[model samples]
Target: MNVTDPKANLAALIKCPSVTPAEGGALGALTEMLSPLGFKVERSTETDENTPDIENLYARLGGEGPHLMFAGHTDVVPVGDEAAWTHPPFAAEIADGQMYGRGAVDMKGGIACFVAAAARYIEKHGKLPGSLSFLITGDEEADAVNGTIKLLERMAKAGETWDACLVGEPTNPDKLGEMIKIGRRGSISGWITVFGTQGHAAYPHLADNPLRGAVQLANALMEVPFDQGTDEFPPTNLEVTSIDTGNAATNVIPAAAKVVFNIRFNDLWTADSVKQEIITRLDKAARTGNLRGERPPVRYEIAWSIRPSHVFLTRDDKLISSLAGAVESVVGERPKLSTTGGTSDARFIKDYCPVVEFGLVGQTMHMVDERVALADLETLTQIYETFIERWFADART
Candidate 1:
């Protein structure tokens, strides 16, 4: 069978419509593409109570020492208004020099480039000296309930392991060789509801306004600095995403106010420590009563999101240096080592092996008509191919 072109592979994937939680034929397409490259592919459908069933792919071309795994997601977020796109979101149309689609860069493009590079390597040099595999998931853009985490757990149960991992997340900010993510900050979300009493605006003595307590609590949460900038990461930051009283009438004082906030914290604090700090802030804020200081003590309930993303850093010389060298050789620029992005599946893969992220420029990811330059696909593939050679060579040493 003729090897599929990387751009073609990406176009095929884009056509799958595998919008998060929807299989959209992305994995099936990948299995078909990898099978021709001598990969032994196995598809697993993972499930949880609330989220939809997700199909994940794990393919290996060889079973040997010092494996290199490429991880990425196939699921793409919904294209807000398809009609608004210059080209059809999933049409995979190539115009001028770019491929236009939803997951083109955020990262079906990454998966395609790596697969193409692996194909070229096998064609030119035969099977890898070690093992070459892919850990592709379909639940990344969603709640992540049945994606990499479950896939990793299942693999561990089945005695699967690897030496290093490179997550194909779009890490570059402005240009293709601008950044490589060496680590990521931890993330946690908190939801709080302050309880008060409902009454007419005229009866200030009878109704305790929850917004008054909420203001104090929010201020306390934002007033204190979580930490200064770490060596690899920036200072911890929090943002209030929402504040809702749900009150419709001008005269009505809602009995409750809900506030939601998320924190992206660095290694200086653990999730437990961060939670404690937040609780402490909330406690102090709760003691602060209404502006008039006449209402009873304010009451509120706090709940943290179930899943907490832990901060991680990778310092593996072989893994980091090889990828950096590859980027420098291909793009003619040394990539900056960074840990400044939001988060990726690398957070989970970090627990298993030393993992870092490098992919195409991410400026257009997740935006309308998300896209990648046609030349970028070829360049990224070359980078991956070079990285593969450097990785296996260094692995032997």
Candidate 2:
């Protein structure tokens, strides 16, 4: 099948219900597309103790220097209330110029467009001037344990290296070329548990409520700003996702309370420094808080979530300018270079090489009817094709 048509490629991928860990034939479909284009495609299934084994693909064309990698995921979040969708989430149905599917915009659409772009480039030039590879994974929407991180490690260990990478995450908020992600904020999550005495509600004087200390600590984390906004990034922000007590009866004060929070920090701090800052705030709140009524530092403990994502920025001029120029040439406007979104697989890729992200509009991602416009898909294909030509040209010079 001719893979130059992005609409056709996206529809084939969308028809596979490749929800995390489920292969769902999405990788197989992708293989079919890349193989015919003369890509030496290799698929690996990575496994960890508890995470479901992941299916990842690395396909390379040409055996030369200045390798460029297009990174993205095939798996999608579960379709919530399948009945709520206008069309079946895996049907790849089209309605009024939009193609609706689970990964339509966040981001099977991106992968489809890139594949089509590569195919078109091959069709036009016969072969690329430099190496081009697709680093596709099936674990982005879940635990993420057995996906890109592992695939990258395996590839690097085998001596595979890339000069730069482009992540096909849904980056635009409203339009196709509105934004391009040059960096991402770091993320860390922790659970705080405070211990107290259980007692009757009427015995307030005798009972120590853990909820009081938990709220105090939670407030401290949010009340103070992490930092003023930076030039390349927004100010760090922390949110209390949940505060819970297992107590069933309102009259009985719970013996313990837990506060769950996640912080998105900027370049102003590293993961360790941000963690230290959090500890300082918690300690200060515990010592000075009146909620415990002089109860010896409001005993508490913290358990950090595993594998915090680190913050990073890409300063590769040629890579950024090539993509930016491509978008401007195709869309008639230079895209804004930004670092405003939550963390992504780009965070992992950044450690290996300079990385940036660009893709379809993200308004409907993870929504009831996630989708992409056909016109936007075509435009994105053009942008990717132009980027391919420009990146290789710039690398040669």
Candidate 3:
């Protein structure tokens, strides 16, 4: 019963085509591995209105203090151009001491390593002192509505609680033990529509050009710094991802212009405050930029994405120090505590418990031939195993 080997466990998970909302038997495979280790596994299917139902796994090995949860998504991103991959994305083929697959690094690999660690711990200790659980979701890559957020909600409704959580989302950028994410910047998107009048290009004076207003609005967002940046986070940045006039004919002035932008903000601002500030900026910019026209003010509409993630920081010295010690002991290097990456499942887990992220180097995640070095797999497994022992000891003390 050496279920604690990453090479076999990860290879099995990568073979599942569990792309986005698809199950591909990944959860079942996880249940099979976890159930043998005295974990009571529950498979839940969650759904949102107009979204596909997603299967999720929640397996717990014990029911005691210092409850530690391991959260990850079994779903993998779509393999873009199968023929371009050196090996089939789902084959889990090992070459040159590396295993190649779609979910090898971005996350199924993390799950496998954690599972291996837990299994090994139980085999050695005869009984795990405190609680250990796995919160595995199948809808992380696409619409996240049916995933961790809902799972946490269900757990809360049932009066379940966790002291802390670790999300396995491939935190390291280039090398193992390089970075550990303690926090992430908040994110929001804005949509703006600028109004104009239709006229011939030859009769430019007769038409109000909305393109000018769109440019001014976009510039208002980009040209100004949102803040000076906080101690744990960088300054906020608003990027204009798209602008469209929708005019096909070279002779006709378009009736409207549209611009879309996203903001990766730090803790200095909330989504609402950022929205208000942006509205103020756009209004001021439009009032000034539209004055050049004789027709009227720049009529426009603005909307925001309904779902927004807020910035969060974990101050749990016990959890941070425990994991850090494990990394140093296993990998021989102290990792950098960073808050530089985009959002992950950690955002949702943070609401329930203090959460941090650490995993394999993510250089190949989502690339053509996503892979994990054979050596890193064993190292990460050792790290997780050591963290489990130290974490329980620290909590008890």
Q: Largest lDDT belongs to which candidate?
A: 2
Q: Using alpha carbons, what is the TM-score of model 2? A: 0.98
Per-residue accuracy of model 2 over 152-268 as CA lDDT, tens digit each: 999999889999999999999989999999999999999999998899999977778999999999999999898997999999999999999988897998899999999999999
Greater-lDDT candidate between 1 and 3: 1
Off by over 4 Å in 3: 290-295
Predicted structure with the largest TM-score when compared to the true one: 2
Cα lDDT tens digits for candidate 3, 295-327 = 455688998888998988999998999999999
Candidate 3 — what's its lDDT?
Answer: 0.90
Residue-pair clashes per prediction, in order, are 0, 0, 0
lDDT for residue 389 in candidate 1, whole number 0-100: 95
Deviation (Å) of 178 in candidate 2: 0.9
User: What local distance difference test score does each model get?
Assistant: 0.91, 0.94, 0.90
